[model samples]
Target: MNESMEAGMEQYLTAGAAGAVAGLGVAVPLGAVGVLVLQQAMRDRRAGAAAGAAVAVVDAGYAALATAVGPLVAAALAGVEAWVRLVAALVLAVIAALGLLASRRPAPAGTTGTAGTETAAPARVFVRFAALTFVNPTTALYFAALTTAQGDTLRGGAAGAVFTFGVFAASLLWQQTLVVAGGFAGPRLPDRARVWTFRAGYGLVAGYAVTVALPLPAL
Candidate 1:
């Protein structure tokens, strides 16, 4: 290959690699969203996949924004950080409450399927999950810091797009793994067990909300 082609390939590869690492860095932590994803996966694979995809898309969008203007966006968010965090905590609390209530109620007889239990329609699931993931500006801040640290590796429009795609791909891979694991495990679990499992997941989400609302002192 000629020098220009070699340089182009290297740029794409570097951006993609950086994005993959950043994606995993953000997604790997089993936070409230992660717990919900696993729980939804246990209940319905399609809904879980839909939820996961929404999260990946939002993550990618944030990554792109961060790459294009990391410092400026980060600075803008800092002014309203408290409000953003408050909104996130409240939303999470509401979701947890709804999930707990849903677990107690019997599934509509026809709705629960062979694969697992039923959730809202996949389209609704996608919007809800997307909103849940997008409300947290911390994810964007994370990518902003990462891009700043990496300097120009993620610069340029083409490089940014490739990086965003890489983030989406890596995040989707991890999210789908959780979904598949839950799907496989759901069938083996008794109905009572699954219901309790969902309850526990919601409880965790509630706890996460508390953490988000109140900052803990550094150890």
Candidate 2:
């Protein structure tokens, strides 16, 4: 019995490490979401931290769900993938437009410091980031694919739980790193440079949205 328990623990740890790798694989890509996180961090460290946490929360939730019911969810979403992609693209475009508009606005009076021109409340920032992350079905689809591919390792129960926990922990670590890095660099940048960064970030997001909205060629 002791030997069996030890083997089970070993399996759990192995599965967890695999999950962390999968999480990092998905999170390391610096896309629209990454740019938004960095922009928020540059504006206000608190908001940046909140945004990062929110993204991590969504990622963790999606990872858990994918591990738990990946096959069923993927099957269900397969039929409507195009529509979901379109909706996600539209949402991203709107967010990019809003960010561009916000960037163009002048900083308010009496707001002096490296805090930048943060107009949104912390709670609002968290919710907005969370919602934006959730709307991108690709995150869920990526997890589902990973879970489906790792059938043997993620055979449910304690191993699955440990794997999910590892994914969440890894994602949080990556996001917090981005937040910290952005916060550190933000203060050093001049106001004009910051504005250009915002514009560039928003423009990139719009480009990403357009790419998502475009149809893929048949294989």
Candidate 3:
């Protein structure tokens, strides 16, 4: 999948092989998210605490959009998210690299999370997703474009809105929780384990990029 310019993100935005079910695939990145939460917690205990709940809120919005607009819209506009993702892999790698580098940066003695303020994970993972999903420029606008593409499908008005909300609730809750759990598990890891996890995670992400670059089916 070639990365589209909708929101500057392309690679990981595709739905699952199961159509709407594919939306849940977003949860798989919890490993990387774990690293972020762990580091954020160590820096600012508060940010880490509230991270999860915030994420759920962000996810709910995306879920709503995904449902109201319909995946078909995104599919039609982008045409094969796998291809779009393939291109976006490079962009994702850049983001991941930035995160890894920032992760390595030493915080000041009193600094906490990246934002300086911290909170416990929200009541649920979906809350975190709902709050944080749009923090990324790509996902935000891309989803909007997909929504616009719906046209008649969106005319269902409240019904469409409700459907979108249901889809979002279902998809985001399932996906965002992965990040919450990852944050909670971070501190328990040993130094060596954490390092290796980073190495392996980046390596796998890199490998995935290579695969995406190839003309293979956009899995």
TM-score for each model: 0.89, 0.92, 0.49
Residue 179's lDDT within candidate 1 is: 89
> What lDDT does model 2 reach?
0.83
lDDT of 2 at 95: 89
Q: Tell me the whole-model lDDT of each prediction, alpha carbons only.
A: 0.82, 0.83, 0.46
Q: How many backbone clashes does candidate 1 have?
A: 0
Cα error of candidate 3 at position 207, Å: 3.9
**Candidate 3 residue-wise lDDT, 1-219, digit = tens:** 344554322211332222234234443345444444444444334554455435444544564565565455555756565555555566546655654564464445554333322333444433443333444434544445555564554434553554344445545465335445555655666544555555555555455556544664444
Show where candidate 3 strays beyond 4 Å. Answer: 1-63, 66-83, 110-155, 175-180, 202-204, 211-213, 216-219
Please provide, for model 2 over 1-219, each residue's C-alpha lDDT reduced to its tens digit, 9 standing for 90 to 100: 999999988998898898789778877898888888898888888888889889888888888888789998888877677777888899999988988887777777867433235556779999999998898877888889988898857847888888888888888899889999999988899988888888888899899888887784233
Candidate 3 has a TM-score of 0.49
